[model samples]
Every structure is written in structure tokens, then in C-alpha cells.
Target: MRDERSRRAAPHRQAAFDGPGAQAGRGGLSSLTRRIVVFNLVALNLLVLGVLYLGGGRDSPLTQYRERMGVEAALIGNVLEVDPAPLSPGAVAQRLEAITLSPGLELLVLAPDGAVLGRRSGDAGAQAEASRTYVLDALGGFWRVFSGVFLGDGPLPEGQDPLGQARAMMGGLQPGAPLSRIAEGATGRFVTTLMAIAPQDRVLGAVALISPLAPLDAMARARQERALRIFALATLVSTLMSLLLASTIARPLTALATAAEVGGKRDPQRPAPARVRIPDMTARSDEIGRLSGALRGMVAALYERIESNEQFAADVAHEIKNPLASLRSAVGTLRMAKRDDHRATLLEVIEHDVRRLDRLVSDISNASRLDSELVREEEEAFDLLALLRSLTGYLGGQAEKQGIDFMTDLPEGEITLRGLEPRLAQVFVNLITNAMSFCQAGDAIRVWVRRRGARVLVVVEDTGPGIPEEALQKIFARFYSHRPASEFGTHSGLGLAISKQIVEAHGGVIWAENMRATGTDPTEGPLGARFVVGLPV
Candidate 1:
């Protein structure tokens, strides 16, 4: 009967999206690893572009020209200091001014105490001022280039020179401090280096070498733009690939889900639909491949279960037919017998055979309908305490006839539940009957109801020989009797199985346990089993 219930409840059709093979393809693309790969690729491209921007254009001729100008200025300063025919400061300043007339160099010379010793122009210390202005311009350009490349915006704050900011950021420079680059705006990059004149490692005044960063700034901006383009392209490509992958993976899963929904109402006569196959990703050993394998295995198992259930149903029908036919024939023979004594004996035999047939048919039928008929249909709110009181009263007579002490410990107040009353009654009856059957004279059957969280638990406990662990699970199987039929008389061994089905169908659970009576003189050995049924409130 349990097997039959499973069969009737099984979906009639292959699930539209049922197979694991289909699901494997559907979810594989959205996994974390794929996302990480795309992220890392984009980051690497940006990093490569940054490295090139910083180092690639340093060897340009414009940079060399700036370096040569600094060298020429230093040589002229030395020549003007020569003995016996050295030029005056004004004459030296004029000579330096003559050289800068060529192009791209702003020259100035400072005395040891920060005074304007010589200069290319005389605009009230104009050469020194021009040199300082160039340094500020160079710092601004570098700041602009650096900021644009990194922050995607305008220059650093005005007023604070970029080179000075860099110096401050690096914790105030000493002589020969390393050259640094900073951005001035979208249009410039500044290179700043401290030039120190020293005699035997004792430092003289330092020249802050400042170069206009227009060329490097342009290159960096170009590199930054290129990096953004590459990143955008990579992102677009990765996104497309992810979508394609996700679709490939999700399609099979969606198909499987659809198939499962359809299968729930499918007719058994039609063959199960073929499982959707995932494209073989065997060239790669990854989650997708594993998922595909799992899906295949699940489909195979489903097929086996269906086939097994079909064979089992056929076997049950075959097993019951002969016994039923014999019972029918025996009843016919008993009715026709003429001698009274012989007729009585035949009648007894017929009765025995009829009982056997009744039990067989009942158990088989109940097992067959277990899943469907036991399913709860009409749910109504009812007091569990009241229900137990009524059941105890109904079964009290039967318990008394067997000389068993029937008692109840139902807690006061309504223990309400949302469930089918008839199904609940059936479950209670089955448990009470089983306890009554096993209980001896003077033995007790205790029925109680208690509330637990969102569920109401009804426990039927008895004092009798406890059920063995080995037979515990099997006791709920169709025609599975723990004691011999001869000892209990003929019984359809489907009561517990039916009770289990009903409880489960109502979204409840039932389990049995052997417990010792508490507060006894010496805790008694395990008494009869306790069956606990829980139903949602």
C-alpha cells in the first residue's frame, strides 16, 4: 500500500525542466570564478597602461633638451667665477640672458644666502622670480597629469605648488632629494629635482630644477584614455560572455523546472521525455562539468524509481489474486454443504479464509490509497484538547472490555490546529487501537495533548512490552506486523502506515519512542511505545 501511494502520487509526465542535466547548464555562468576572472583582466590592463605612461616617454628629445639646458647653465656659472678676468654680476647676468634667447630655458643663479647672484633678465630680481615661477608651473603641470590619470578630473588645488605638495607629502626633502612628477592640469606634467652644489659633501645652496610637463602630461593623458577604452571594451566583452554563459547554463535548469511542473500532472501512459543534455565541457574540468554529471545521475535515478514502482504494483496484484479466488470458492462450497455438523465445520473454515481475505484486501487497498486518500482535504480550526477528550471517551469502552486502564492527561484550554478533522481522527484511532491491542489487564493507556511552538502534539502512550529497534521502521510498512497474526487475530496491518501517511499529508510528522515511567520507585524498564503526532496550529 505504501508503494502504491507513492506510485499514484508520482507525476504522470516527465518534468519539463526536471532533469539535473538541464539545470547544470543554467546556473554555471553566474558563478564567482567567472566574475573574478573578468575583474582581474580589467585591472591588469589598467595597471599595464599606467606603467607605460610613467616610463615610456621619458626618453623623448624634449626631455633631453631640458637636461642639456640645465648643464649649460651650470657650466656658464662656473666660467663666470673664473679668476683674473671674471665678469661682474651684471655682465654675467647679461651673458646668461643671451643664451636663454634661443628657446625653452629660463635661467637664474642664486647666491649662497638665497640672494639673486645673477640672472638672464633684470626685472627687480626677475630671473630668480622667473625660475621660481617655472618651478611652480612645472609642479602644477605634473599634478594635473597625475590627478587626471588617477582621479579622472581637473588639476590639484591651486595656490599650493604641485612640487611643494609632493615635497611635503614625502616628508620635507634633503639635498639631492629624488626628482618627482606631479600634474598641473589636464594639459601638463611637472618634473622636479633638487640640484645641490657641494664641496666635500658639505652642501651649498640647492637649485630646484623645474621643467614644464606639457609633453609627459599629454602622453599620460593619452595612456589613461587608452586604458579606459581597453577597460570598457574588456568589460563589454566579459559581460557578453557572462550573459551567453548564464543563458547556456540557466536554459537547461529552466527547462528542467518546467518539465518537473508538467510532470506533476503527466499521464503515465506516455513515456517520460528524454532528458536535455548539457553541452560537454569535458575539455575543461570545472563546476559546470561536475554539475552536468550530477544532473545525468539524477535523471537516471528518477527513471529507475519509476520503473521499480511499476513492477511493484504488478507484483502486489499477482500476490493477492490467488488468495481472493480461494476465499470466494471456499464460501461457495460452505453454502452448499448439506450435513449440519459438516456444514458448521466448513463454515468455520470459510470464516477463517474470509477473515484472511478481508485483511489482505483491506491492507492492499489502504496501502494503494495511502498517499492520495490520506492527503488532508478540508482543514478547519478545532481544539486538540476537545478532540482528545472525545477520542478517549469513544475508545474508553474498548479499553475497558480488554481490562486495560484508559486514561487521559489533556491540558486545559483549547489547543487549536488547522487540519482535516476526519484525518486527524483516523490517526488518533490507529494509535489508540494499537496501544489497546498490546495493553494487558490493569495496564494503562495514556492519551495527552500539549502545545509546542506553532504545533500541537498529541501523544498516545501505553504500558506494554516495548517495540524492538529492528522492527521500528518496518512497523509502518504495509502488511508488516510485529506480532504473529494468530496472537492478535486477523488484522489489516495497514493501520500504522495509514496513520503515518495521514500525518505527513497534513504537513505533520509522527514518530514513536520507548520511555521509562518517571518518578517510579525504581525507574521501570521501557514500557509500551509512545507515538507523538505533531500538527501545525
Candidate 2:
């Protein structure tokens, strides 16, 4: 039997010890840490992409290159305007080339008659040679595609370089103002600045400065590299911080979930497992901490209830056995006895035992079902004083018939309370009747109520032999009785226990104490037994 039980409990035992990793194996409570880190990294990268796009569109290196080229072109036109020598194609070209131009610029001089004078390369000849390398061409191609997609610009037209494009625009046109434009090239784009070299409005000629956009492309690449490096560092830091936050949340919640799983299983035929301790997170002062405290409290209540039920069952068995054994002995005696009077006495003994057994069974069944009934019942506001008046009026008549003084000191007007009325009525009824049972003829029983702050107190006092000091705490426990010998078989011990269950279910308290003559003398005999019930009002 032991081996079979162990086999049945093996899985549950394993479940109790399972950690978050084990739960994750079963796809339970997935890692919030991973999700947090992933989301932060993704958002960070998106922000970087947006910054790159916006920065490249409005304030790009290409824009700066055009502005610089325009300034250089204006300066060159000024230099040509001051020269006093007659214009010639060779002279124009030679003079222009002598003036050092910014790198990657090509200079062209046109005659006043619209004849092609001459063209001279600045530093462009060397740069053009370098630009033809496979590596440079490939890098320029990549930059062109990248700028096209993200910066809302497209590739340059085929078969057209910046020089040819500028010459075409300058043909058959007389400039009235300094003009700047972008021209496409085979390998890249260019910034072209045009200025009329007309000294004193006589139109000496026009000088065209064409600057390659390769340097701007390099600037853009460098900018992008820096941006990416910063993004990577930010992503790393944000992801680590997210992981730490997730750990604070996920680990404690996981522990709580695991504890709930282990303790929450209900098996009627099996004994309860060892108590599971929920992790204490109450110091956090957050929602998770509140949840932890609530769960711990719930588990404590559940274990206490389970232990109480186990003890109740054992007590039930023991109580029933006493009556059963008495009846059995009585029956045997009745069968052996030959005298009529002896047989009659044996029959009465058997009857009393049978009655005792019946009472015990009835009370046991009611007590067993009390917990569920208390949970299922709904509470409503009612007049507490009115309910007490009704009980005292009805039970007082019964006390009078038994020659005992029944008194009530109930206050006037209604004291309102919210609770299951019938259940609370049962509680008061049990307290009054139990007190009456302890009292004899000529003894007095008093039932009274008093309001104290938010609570209403109900006291039941009887002028009978007070309970023993040792039994005061145990009086409300199931099957615990302190009645006289003659009263033993006549009453079941569940009345006070059931009363306590009902009172507590309504968020109230019930306690028994001996009423003494003076406040503090332990040697003095108790005047009577007093039962006090306090309920929220």
C-alpha cells in the first residue's frame, strides 16, 4: 500500500520542487525577460534608422559640398573679371588652371562669340584616375543606391558626365545671375556652379566649375558609421537594463506560480502534501508584492482548514464508537437477562445509546457541511437588535417552563449588520440553548447586547457551574463537551463548534470565559460561564 501511494504521489512531489526552468520546459510562464530585451533593441534600431533618413535628407554632406563649390566658382569669376588682357582660348584655359581649384573640380572657359575656347582640369585629372578603381566605383555605386532608397533620390542618367551636362545647360544661354545646379555623372553626381565672367557688362566669357560628389559620399558613409556605433552601444545598455527589470518582475511571479501549482491540487482520497512556502515579496510596495501577500494568506487559511478537517474526522469516529459499544453491550445483556425488570432496564440503555448515536451522526453531518454552506450563502443588511429580540422572546418562554430565570438586556432601536441572517441566528440560538442546558431550575440565564465602536457584542451568561479553566480554550472544538454525567448522552458536542464556525464566517469572533465575582483572583470560583460574540455592525 505504501509503495502504491508513493507512486501516485511521485508526480505531485516532483511538481512541488519544480523551478521556473522546469515550468518553462512545459511551456508555462514564458520568459518575459527575452521579450523585454527584444522589444527595446528593435525600437532603438528603428530610431537610428529614422535619424539617418532625416539627417541625410535635409543637412547632408552633398548640400555642404554644393555650397562650397558655389563660393569657389564666384571667386574665380571675380579673378577673371579683374584681368585686363585680351581673351584667347589658350590664355583663358592656362590662366584658369593656374588658379588652384578645390579637388575634383574641372574648369572650362568659353569665348564671347560662343566658341569653345579650352578646358583644363584642376585636381580632377588625378581624382578621376583614382575614381575609376574597382573599389571606389563599387563604394560609389553602393552610396548611390543607399541615398536613392532612404533619402528620396535616384541614380544619375546613363552616358552623361557632369562636364557634358553643364556644357549643354550653358549652351545658347546668357546668364543674368549666378546659378547653381546638380548634374549627373557616370560614376557619381556633381555640384556645378556657373558664373558669367562679364567685366563692366561687356561679357568677357563664362567660367564653369564642376565638382565631383565623391567626397560628399565619403562624408555620408563616415556619418552613417558613427551613427551605427552609437546605436549599437545604446542597444546593449537598454537590453541589459530591460533584462534586470524583467528579472525583478518575472522571477518572483514565477516562484508564486510554482507555489500555487504545488499547493493548489485537490485530491480527496490522498493525504495533503507538505506545506509550500510562497516567496515573501511584500516589501516591494508594488502589485506583485500585494499578490504575494494575498496568496500566502490564502495558503495559510487552506492548510489550517485541512488540519481542522482531519482532526474533526478522527473525533467523529471516536465519538460514534462510544455509543456503538454501549449499545452492543446493552443488547448482549438484554439477551442474557431472564428477569423482566433487568430486561426493561437493558432495553432503556440500548434506546439511550441509539439516540445518542443518532444525535452524533446528525450533528456531525451538519458540522461537516458548514464550511461550504457559509461560503455559498449571501449576506444582506438586517436589524441585529430585532433578531435578538425574537430569539430572547421565544427561548425565554422555554426557560420559564423549566423554572429558570431568563432575562434579556437588549437595547432599543435597530443595530444594522450585513450577514447571512439565518446562519447568524443559528449561532445565537446555539449559544442561548447551550447556556440553558448548563443551568438547572432556579438558575438564571441572561442574554444582552452592547454596541462598541464598529462592533456589536452579544453576551450569554448562565448561573451554573462555570467551565474548568483547562477546558475554556477547547470548548469550541468539535466533539469537545464539558456537560454533567447525566447530560453526556443527551447532547452532541457540535453545537458550540458549529456556532463558532458560523460566527467567524460572518467575520466575527466567539469566545468562552468564566464569569468571576472579582476581576483578578484565580483562586475564586467562577460565578458562571460567559460566551461573548462580537460582530461588525
Worst 10 residues of 2 by lDDT: 13-22
Best by lDDT: 2
Candidate 1 local lDDT, 44-75, one digit each (tens) = 66776776666558675446655654565345
State how far residue 489 of model 2 sits from its true place (Å): 1.7
Candidate 1: which stretches are off by over 4 Å?
A: 1-315, 318-322, 325-340, 355-359, 373-381, 452-456, 464-470, 483-489, 513-527, 535-537
TM-scores for all predictions: 0.46, 0.72
- Please give the range of 10 consecutive residues that has the lowest summed lDDT in model 1: 122-131
In model 2, residue pairs whose N, Cα or C atoms come closer than 3 Å (at least 3 residues apart or on different chains), thus clashing, are none
